[model samples]
Target: MKVYISADMEGVTGLVDAEDVQPPGRDYERGRGMMTEDVNAATRGAFAAGAAAVLVNDAHGPMRNLLPDLLDPRALLIKGRPKPMGMIEGLDSSYDAVLCVGFHARAGVLGVLSHSFMGHEIEDIWLDDQVTGEIGLFEATASAYGVPVVLLTGDDTACAEAVAWNSSIRTVPVKYAKDRFAAQLVPVAEARSAIEAGAREALRSLPSAVGAGARTLSVRWQSASVVSHLTAIPGVARRDDRTVTVTADMPQLYRLFNLFLRVATAVTSNPPYC
Candidate 1:
C-alpha cells in the first residue's frame, strides 16, 4: 500500500498556544520537534503495515513546519507554500490511503488551537450545508481522487469530528481539550505509541469510507471585504455580507476552495480594503 500523510502542528502532543505553532515564537521550535516525532510514529506504523511508500506533507502555517531531518527516513516529505491543495497537496489517485496527523477542530469549536483554513479570517466552511473544518475538507478532497483517510491523529474534539465524518477511520487523540488554548495532554511517548498502533490498524483494515458527494462549498468569512472580493470571481455567489458560496463537485470543489483561500488571504485589514 502507498499512503499520503498530512502533518500540522496545533494538535500535536504538548502544544496548546500560538506560541507553540506559529513561527518565531518562544516554543515554536520545540513544537515542530513534537510534530516531527508524531509524523515519524505514523510513518513507522504505515511501514509496519506493509506500505510501500509514504509522503508527508507539511500542512500548517507557512507550510514548512516539519523537521525533515527528524522525519522517518522511509517517508518522503513535501514542504513549501503556494500549494494549491494546502493540506492535501500532492494527493492523487495513485495513493491507497491518507493519514491526517496533528489536526484541530473547526473555528468556534472546543479544541486546542482550533480554527479552519485561515485562523483569524475564516468563520466557518460548509460542505453542502454541513459545517466542516480542515478534516472534513481534506476528507472530501481525497475522496474526489478515490482515496480514503485511514487514520487521523489530533485532540479529543478532532477525533470526535473524525468519527462523525467516518466511523471506520481510526483516530488517536493525543490530548483532551479544556478550551481552545489548553488541553489535558497525554505524555509524548504515550501519544507516539497510540499513533503508531492506530496507523498500523487503520491501514491493515478495510479501505476508508468516502464522505458525502458534496456539490457546494460555502464559506463564512470574518470580514465583509473578503466576501466582496470573492464575489467578484466568476461563479462565486454572495450569500450575505459575511458569506460567499461556490458550486462544484469533488476535485473542482477542492480547487475552487483553495483559489478562494488564496484570494481571501490577500484581503487587507486596512481601510478601503476592509
Candidate 2:
C-alpha cells in the first residue's frame, strides 16, 4: 500500500493557541517539534501496516512548517504552497490511501484554534449544501483522486468530524477541546502512540475507509468584500455578500477551492494585492 499524509499544525498534540502554530510565539518551535513527531508516528505506523511508500504534505500556513531534517526518513515531504492542489497536492489515483494529521474543526466551531483554510477570511465552507471544515475539504480532494482518507489525528472535535464524515475512518484524538484555545491533552508520548496505532488500524481496515463523490463546493467569507474579490474568478458565482458558490466535479471543485483560498489570502493579507 502507498499512503499519503496531509499534515497541519493547528491540531497537533499540545497545540491550543495561535502562538503555538505561528512564528515568534514562545512555544512555536516546540509546537513544530510536536507536529513533526506526530507526523513521524503516523508515517511509521503506515509503514508498519505494509505500506510500500508514504508521502507527507505540510498543509499549514506557508505550507513549510514541517521540519524536513527531523521528519521520518522513510517518507518524502512536500513543503511550501501556492501549488495547484494545495493541501492534497501530489495526490493521485496511484496512492492506496490518504491520511490527515493534526487537523482541526471548521471555522466558527468550538475546536481548539478552529478555523478553515484562512481563518481571517473564510467563515465557512460548504460542500453539496453541507457545512464542512478543513477535514471535509481535504477528504473531498482525496476522494476526487479516488483515494480514501483512512486516518485522522487531532483534537476531540476533529476526530468526531472525521468519523461523522466516514464512520469507517480511524481517528486519534490527541486532545479534548475546552474552548477555542483551551484543551485537555494527553502527553506527547501517548499522543504519538495513539497516532501510530490509529494509522495501522485504519490501513488494516482497507477499502471501507475510502469514499468519494463531491458535486458542488462553496465558501462563505468573513465579509462581503472578501467574497466580492473571489467572485472575479470565472465560473465562481456570488451567492450573497458573504458567500460564493461553484458547481463542478470533484477535481475541478478541489482546484477551485484552492484558487479561492489563494485569492482570498492574497486579498486579505498580502500587501501587493491590497
Which predicted model would earn the best lDDT?
Answer: 1
Task: Give per-model CA RMSD.
Answer: 2.7, 2.7
Please, what are the lDDT tens digits per residue for candidate 1 over residues 116-165? Answer: 87886888888889999888888888887889888899999999998897
What are the runs in model 1 whose C-alpha is more than 4 Å off? Answer: 208-214, 269-274
lDDT of 2 by residue, 1-274 (tens): 8899999998899999878988767889998889999999999899999999999999888788898899989999999868898888889989989889999988878998888877756777888888998888788777777788989999999989888977767889999999988999999899999899989888986763344554778788776877888878888888888999888778778878888777776667632101
| Local accuracy by lDDT, each model | 0.87, 0.85
TM-score of each: 0.95, 0.94
Backbone clash tally (model 1): 0
Clashing pairs in 2: 63-80
Model 1: lowest-lDDT 10 consecutive positions: 265-274
